[model samples]
Target: MTTRARPAIAAMAYHQGAFVPFAEAGLPLTTQALQYGTGVFEGIRAHTCADGGKLVLFRVRDHYERFLRSCRLLRIETGHTVDELVEITCELLRRNGTTADTYLRPLGYKLALLPGTRPGVGLSGVSDALSITGFPMGAYTPPGGIRCTVSSWVRPRSAAIPIHAKVTGGYVNNALAADEARAAGYDDAILLDDRGRVCEASTANVFAARSGRLLTPPATADLLPGITRDTVLALAADLGIETAEHELDVSDLRCADEVFLTGTGIGITPVNEVSGHPIGAGEPGPIARSLAHHYARTIRGGGDVRHHHWLTSVRIDQG
Candidate 1:
């Protein structure tokens, strides 16, 4: 049967061994990642860097490092090392000639399938396959700001699953909450922890500023300790904004003067609503704006000298 055509956006994908049109980037129905979410992946971002007058990948190494850790934990073999993954990502972007905001995804998936069959429903460790894909992406909230709801779904406790590994299956839980929000006439969703505490956005880590202190969920809250999350914590310190990470409940979120979300795919998005109540003036706040501006400039190789550790320039071969 002829495959349905992919729109221009997803038609071409960087697939197994090389770039291929979407119709050709096919795998057998028994693929492990397809069956059970036996896969690990990372969401990476490339920003327009002032230093090189080009889009610079932000903390690509860190993301790859985490990727390696995830593969190790998930018992899947990622054919390439973290460094190799970084090289492949940069090359893919180079080929795409993307200069504006772009997103990178490198996934390591189980390959050796068990004889029993069902796509999207298996959970045994087998062999692995690694694939990388890239696309030009725009802003998450477009800086204008967006509203989000506190999801009825709560993040599973650590006893339930590993939140740090970024397993593809973990996001099925995320997608569920996100889909619920859209169905309810909202753009995004926020999840609480199993203990009924604020956790994170459906797809991004959440943060807020109140009493002049920058506050976020402690790593225990089931939120991914995001790379951008780390950046903001340190960025807040540099800006002399007191930063704190602790268990935050819904009341704290509702009463906070300002709220925001952060992730690789969506730098920093203001949270205008929580549990249907409008967040602080219902607009992006001063601290969110400051951090966003500083983050935009910092990722582009500006002001901070010590943070150079976060950036990697695209070094191409002379072939």
Candidate 2:
């Protein structure tokens, strides 16, 4: 049984508008976000290139843009512009002095309630706070492929919760689905919508290769439209591979020639089986391999020149 890999976080963290020792970064027991799960966060990755020892942040601005949007949904004010957030991330990386593949988590959340305001369950009249933390992490999923199960927990509709944003409270649904899959001896969970349409995996977007084309659920399928998912679409277009966004169900996953997932954490991971049924030949297929290779190079500061704009370079100096 393959277990989830854990990352070693750096000693320092940016907390509450100041950089501090990770041990010193803490919230009060009565903090609203801690109590109510009224927080938003983004998962960002920075890759270290072998050629020049440069650490490049992938789609940092885009991540923060989505971060701010998620914050807005919860009325959590980050008080930082996209450019400012990017700069803070770069500065934090420099301070941490980590020269490896790193994962960043920027959290914006509700803090304590206002003095005159009474809170029972609300979004208004709460203080807001922001914290950014980094972890030294690399690709952890099996490149060969992984087994998955169709989760029994259906994804909550957007009407009930905004599925597009990475709101902290909204992840309980994903956690339940993932736990159910892992407990059943599967690597991850593929959740379906209330209408039985394939929503997405626990933490990543779904993609299936069929007839030499890539098919994924549309943004309307109550799934988080990941930045990595968008990147794959553009890269596929560059490679002349056809792509489509539509609804998919359990049968579609079982019938596809290849199944894979894309996200900051998983990157491009092939899915070999779904609920004990083999996907295609039950192995990682060629198209997935090709895109994974291309994605690796693209993030590490290689690949086509046009795609370089997606990376924000940070130079690391030896001490």
Say which candidate scores most in lDDT: 2
- If scored against the real structure, what TM-score would every candidate get? 0.89, 0.98
- Report clashes for each candidate as comma-separated counts: 5, 0
Give the Cα-based TM-score of candidate 1 against the true structure: 0.89
> Model 1, residue 8: displacement in angstroms?
5.4
In model 1, what are the clashing residue pairs, if there are any?
34-120, 35-120, 35-121, 35-122, 36-122
Please tell me which predicted candidate would have the highest TM-score against the true structure. 2
lDDT of 1 at 87: 78
TM-score of 2: 0.98
Angstrom error of the Cα, residue 225, model 2: value is 0.8
Superposed model 2: Cα runs more than 4 Å off? none
lDDT of 1 by residue, 170-270 (tens): 89889999888878877788898877888788778889789788889887667789998998998999999998888888888888999999988778888
